[model samples]
Target chain A: MDVDTDVTSGGGTARPWPIVDINPEALAALESYKKRDPSKVVVRFKAVGNAPIMKQNFYKITASNRFQAVIQFLRKELGWKAGDPLVPHTPPRFASPQLVLNKPQFTYINLAFSPAPDDTVSNLFKSFCTDGHLIVNYSTTAAWG
Target chain B: MSQYGTTRGPPQAAKDRTTDYHTALFRRLSWEGTVPLEIRVDPNELPANSDRGLACYFVQAPRVSYLPLLMPEIRRFLMDVVFDEAASKSLKEEDWWFEIDDGTLLKWHWPIGLIYDNHTILTTIRPGPSLATTSTTPLRLILHLASPPTDKLLLAANAEACKQAFMGQLKEADFIRWGNTKRMTGLRKADQDGLWEGIKEHNFEEYWRVASKVTPTTTANRPQSPGPPPSSVSMHGRPPSADTSAPPERDGAYNVRSVPVRLYLPDGPVIQDLVPPLLEDGSPHTLAHFLNTHAPLLFPPQPPAPPPSRTNPNPRPPSHQELAYPLVQGILAPLDSEMAWLGACLAGADGWVNVCVGISRK
Candidate 1:
């Protein structure tokens, strides 16, 4: 039996891995978001000091897309392998502030502020952005007070 | 009153009651009297030997008129009591200029209060009484010669009058519409539109384009060698246009609201030029917008001109016409992120902004 696989030999019962008990409210919210146009919402990202340039700075994310989408996309773009920490414990000199593979801090309009990880892209953008486009500044630390 | 609950009032009685209410409302709503405008001047401008009674006279601003209509009255007051013979003669020729705190020179027609109102200068000054006592306070407005005043008497008189007038007015400005007043309430939708076509059409174009000398007196007096550097890379040294005040014409439209910006490219000569207006709603004037719209204009395709001849090895860098945009990809980085806002980038008194541009990889 593979350790990664969820299985019990004694009872022969199958267990679903990474189980989430779905709620109706959350399901309704997702369904509503699906009906609306996703392109209307755009998130604009800017590279910090000495950060590696992003191939595409402006990304159109659906209203339902979570903050995790951004982190995952960044990880994929940076070609970070699995088991690589999102928040690097050790300081790496070659590490670009733009591609900070650590507890990255993000600011909206003001440099000092950061949004919660659970915030939906559309909601966050609508609240914090200008001209229906949210400009997100990413840095390894809170850049300004 | 007792029978009113049981039965409706007669038609004639009801009509009389309504008429009475309307008359009372009309009386209250009618213009009562002229509002007293405060005429604050720089107390320092007042002559030390002048009558103490002159201070009291300034406090009584000519009422029921805006600055334009009231200017004649003020001029008369100045000519009669304050101005010397030469100063009085200059008034007739319209050789004088009015300067606001921000170095904005104005003519007689432009309303003085509007500048004070828009900039919130007086309010900022009034709060800190300690700052008021300082001797080296910058005078708000002065009526000096077109050239620096040679006559000591006239200069002293001008200073005295300006200070006296400024202080008097600041003491008690009438409850005038400074910001977001009743008129603004009517313009709620227009304000949201942000371009303010109404404000644009207020026929302020003439006044806004007040043609005085470009260089300040202080700067003009400075030694030639140590003078301000020439805006070498700027496409338009001085724009070709009738209106001296406006930035320049762009795409057949006059960009009246532009500020002079010096675009510093990496290891390249700085391109100093007026940036076009940020759209009314404060959207679309981003770094991307500048690159897309202006970069092409600033850096058009370089013509396949022959290489620099051996004799003239140092051919000048690409002029505005010769430069090309396709190879030019760069990110504009202001010192601070807020400088990204077009307004903040160049709202300085000098109307100049220094922007750093880094070449971007395709």
Candidate 2:
């Protein structure tokens, strides 16, 4: 008999793998995940300053998706590759030595803060969405202070 | 509270002074907090004849600082211990990254304390003669000087790259707090330089001088009158048609738009939500409210079940177990701590409250 053969192949004494039941309490805890809305959120993109505008501004993305997805989507639509440096519109006074050295693409929400890449779409939609859409502003240059 | 009134010139000023005193004390503690680290080199990166024991280096890293800041000293120490001049010359700061025991690549951009807390689970060991009773264990990290996992981790090429990233985070936090980056953008070039210099030099006074302007200290500096709610701030950085006359109040008392909070969840992506400082009814929101709102599964609204009762003797654990603890500046802050107060005093050098959720094994 091959040692690698199934346990049940030759011996009547072979026993089935032990089956352990999961805690019902732990199962009930998953109700929170079940309660969350799995619907897609509408993200509307608007160009600021010298940034190019997309033909179709509205997109429906999974609510659980990160804001980074929106950024990558915008980058794809705008034909800008990742790590490509854009001309910064930094004012003389605002420009520091480090700003010139490392320049990443700028994307803003509500013309306000740039959400981190890891921020969830649902959180942004819940907090900042207006008119049933989360408005995202993108710029190749530093659009606003 | 009455005793303070008796000793001071004016009650309001005295209160402000007391608050300031406390804020300074807390801020100093946060700045000076350090994490004990045991760093080891990747065996592949070391010479074949190198002694494993000699390769390990131990240091107390400041919580507020970044790994890249201490890279030079760590590299120098390693050179003196294991490598020859030729081998050490090949080692560069830009080519380094750190890994935990479980092969998790640490993000260099985050503060040292955050990285440690997020990765390490702290269990309180019972006090005994032979064993230490400290709750914390030394964070063990493996340093790689070869290929970096660029896909997972951002490149902190050099000190300059780290500085740029830090400035970027400051602007992000400023925008979140004020709905605009004016506080950061309006900073003079010297003050901007000072912020980075202060952290490098570990000068509390120097850092706060520049940082205080960027962060809102009291209600006085926050927006007093609630003009158009943040929802009205239009997409183009302009107010909507209805509230065109009065632009959002850029500065006022108790007017913090949102608290820049980064919640680090174990086995999940970081959650950065737009957390308003005050509720609609002008009440301060607490850490408990914030966590309950964002992470209901981990921090359920229901209170923990009572201990074993007399009749029951042994009660089943709660259905929704509170599985994690929120740690800020290496301490479990009271859940009732006000968001505004926490934002002002306990934020990291990047101007964000980095709350690391340490998951319990039990």
Candidate 3:
């Protein structure tokens, strides 16, 4: 029933495959690993709902930049027209639509209203995002109250 | 002909007609998704011993269709009870459709159909017809219990008129201005009276005046820059390998960035002695990954000591310190993200913030 027993028992010495040892090579690499550039943070956007995905959804943004940077990028990609008299067909768009907070199992909390335009992406990301990249759901209309 | 000279009591048939109308209205609502809410009309408002004191109604029907059904009912009730025949007829022929708020904001508008659903409404106004109009006070409206079989109008105000009165003052623009603000968590229907009681007790004007202001950016656009060009380094679910062959991975490298964070022990012994001063990383490290890789440095498991040494027969019991490592839990707290960066977490503090690392309690 245990197929692994044959190969493992063939050798008189039966031990786990990974017999790790202390090596100086691993230690010498620590210095470079500790350092971080801090100037830029990468953003990977994934579309949710009926929102269209960008051709290139990945981009590096300055960590200090505000969340509006992402909003602005999304508006441009979607070809949304602002309230302009000349653009009569275009509807007036709210500067901030609902940005929902999502984690794997946690309830989908509506980041309703606040996290003002001035709030930095890095701060929001550190406060809410998961993994290295932030995943946000963008919609033309408010998804939740 | 009904009342020639003396004031005759309202016709007996009038009472029966009112009952018929109410019965029909309720039967229609039973089929709709929304539950018909009941409002206990004041005892004084109704005629002597009348059973029609309570008003049962719903807000599911849109203003366009609702006005036709509603306006006639109000007009008839006024003529029969409060007004004389001529006085009720002379009342202005105004449009009731325009009376309802047509706000595009989340709080002001709900899609029609599900008349009974757990809906959360947020607004900055007080809960009555008379709105407290001050530029600063934040208002919220929470309508809950849609799919969940909960009481209708579960909060303090249950009347259809009361809900509409709250909606009347909310402008769409005000919501757009406040939507991105991170300060207010607002009230919810599920939050038993405590949240409502707190809100009700506070004077909106006085609250705003006394509260320390954390300035909100009402209007501002993001600074424009040509966004980053596409890079070949795609981290599509695979672990990132160190750039060993290329130039040494240094602080100045394009991809390397540090999110410094402060960490501490909530219950375990002071961590400085147990772990290294700094942990090495290139890719982002989740709390689980960070602890797993550094297990040897942080919490090395002790092998059972070879029985009693012949030299010393008297064996001391293993100290409490030598016990197996307790299961550790990490928290970003306040900011409860799974993979929060060390640098971003530290950015607010002088250099780093003290995050606790302790045995998982729950």
Among the numbered candidates, top lDDT falls to 2
Would you estimate the TM-scores of all the predictions?
0.20, 0.71, 0.22
- The C-alpha RMSD of each candidate to the native structure, in angstroms, is 33.2, 11.4, 29.3
DockQ, prediction 2: 0.11
| Candidate 2 global lDDT | 0.67
> Highest TM-score: which candidate?
2
Q: How well is candidate 3 docked (DockQ)?
A: 0.02
Q: What is the lDDT of residue B181 in candidate 2?
A: 79
DockQ head-to-head 1 vs 2, winner: 2
Q: Predictions ranked by DockQ, top down?
A: 2, 3, 1
Per-residue CA lDDT of model 2 for B1-362, tens digit only, reads: 22221111223431242335556677888999998888999888885555567888888888888888888888888788788777777767677889885687887677788877666422211111100113345777899887787756754456776776678778878867766678888989899989989878878889888987887664223322344433323322433453354343333213466788877665445667777776654455678898888767667676566688899888765675445567888788777777777787788988889876654322
Computed on C-alpha atoms, the DockQ of candidate 1 is 0.01
Candidate 3 lDDT, B1-362, residue by residue in tens: 23211111223342232222322232223222122322222333333333343232233332112222333554455456654555445545241111113221121122221111111111111121111111121122121112222122111222233233222111111122122222222323333223222223322232222111211111111111232211113322112443433332121112212222323322111121111112232222344443444333433333445468888577664543321122111112322222222322111101122234322110
Off by over 4 Å in 1: A1-145, B1-64, B90-93, B101-113, B121-140, B144-362
Give one digit per residue, the lDDT tens place, for model 3 in A1-145: 6576523343324343321221233222222333333677667755545455445666787766655566666666445433234866754443322221221111011233223333356654553444676555555443432
Q: Report lDDT (CA) for all predictions.
A: 0.33, 0.67, 0.29
TM-score of chain B of 2: 0.79
Best by DockQ: 2
lDDT of 3 at B45: 36
